[model samples]
Target: YAKTSRTELLHFTVGGKDAGWMDKRAFTATLDKATYSKMSRGAKIGDAAVSSKHGLYTKPNNTAEDGEKIGLGSLYANQNVQIIQSAKLSTGVT
Candidate 1:
């Protein structure tokens, strides 16, 4: 595990690519690793900028159109899912 310190830099990967330096002026809080990377890299599989203040490297989120890519959200490991409705878009009886 990495040491605990305010200066402790976080290292992560996006779409199999490594994240670069995250310094004080480079990155800030409320910017989670995944979210930050996505914003920075312009929501693509490689490095780019989503906003002036955020750098990311992945597709930000999913719309109904992202059928094959929907599984990307599942990479979070701890995320839990439960179907709230049926294929017919009716209230599930179960």
Candidate 2:
């Protein structure tokens, strides 16, 4: 399996009527054959703590950009504000 840091905006309908939107992370979207096999055998996958269960994804290190802000922390603050940047626009993860 390949690893990537990407997110996608998904729009879909359930039961052909209900519509919804979500931010889908690429890393946990699908499972590879080998990892599936291991899971089928009752083996834990992905990152694990010493006293806890393992995660599903083989390499779940996915991250999303929440944008960068360069301004006053409080809205009431009387300070010069700088420009604020938004997160990158993404169609899908490669």
Candidate 3:
């Protein structure tokens, strides 16, 4: 396995597209729906917090309404390790 350091810079990708730069030590975790909702509502997980006007949901086979693109939450990843710069959204197609 390749070893990574906290200072190492790496490209973050989603579905083969470049998202942004992130520290090698940075990563994300899946939280329960309740925790996710809380974070979206300005709740903190430890010292990290997030706030958004919309709720996270999945509409399977759902098309975008009113030309609204699907959203990827800024806090979808763990806030503690996020060091992203010039972050970009992914189409999530591979």
Candidate 4:
């Protein structure tokens, strides 16, 4: 395990790709105060949270039309779905 400090960013990978970094706040939020304290004292955080039990879901082989019918609330909504990052649809950069 890599040495991780409270202020340092925690890097994580999914499917052998760089998913992103978990800042101190986000990383702490995942655990209780005791667990965070233990980690702060040098205990390692396991990769169990990255498993299927977490929010990660498998994409279904379905068309967009079918996805709409199933409702966006469903876990199998769409494979290419992404969280909206901003109010603007496009910045006209292209």
Q: Can you write out model 3's per-residue Cα lDDT over 1-94, one digit (the tens) per residue?
A: 1336536666767999989887655755332222111122343223223434333334311222223335544445344443222212233321
lDDT (C-alpha, whole model) for all candidates: 0.34, 0.34, 0.39, 0.35
Predicted candidate 4 versus true structure: per-residue lDDT over 1-94, tens digit per residue: 2346546566888899988777644543331111111112222222443322334212221211122232233243323343422121122221
Better of 3 and 4 by TM-score: 3
- TM-score computed on alpha carbons, candidate 2: 0.21
**Clash count, predicted structure 4:** 0
Per lDDT, the best of the predicted structures is 3
Q: Write the residue-wise lDDT of candidate 1 on 47-73 in tens digits.
A: 222122332223332212222333433
Judge candidate 1 at residue 73 and give its lDDT. Answer: 32
lDDT for each residue of candidate 2 in 1-94, tens digit (9 for 90 to 100): 2223665666667789757666655224433222111212222222223312322221322322332333322332333434232222233322
The estimated TM-scores of all candidates read: 0.20, 0.21, 0.21, 0.20
Instruction: TM-score winner between 1 and 2, please give it.
Output: 2
Worst 10 residues of 2 by lDDT: 32-41
Worst 10 residues of 3 by lDDT: 31-40
Pairs with backbone N, CA or C atoms under 3 Å apart (clashes), candidate 4: none
Candidate 1 steric clashes: 10
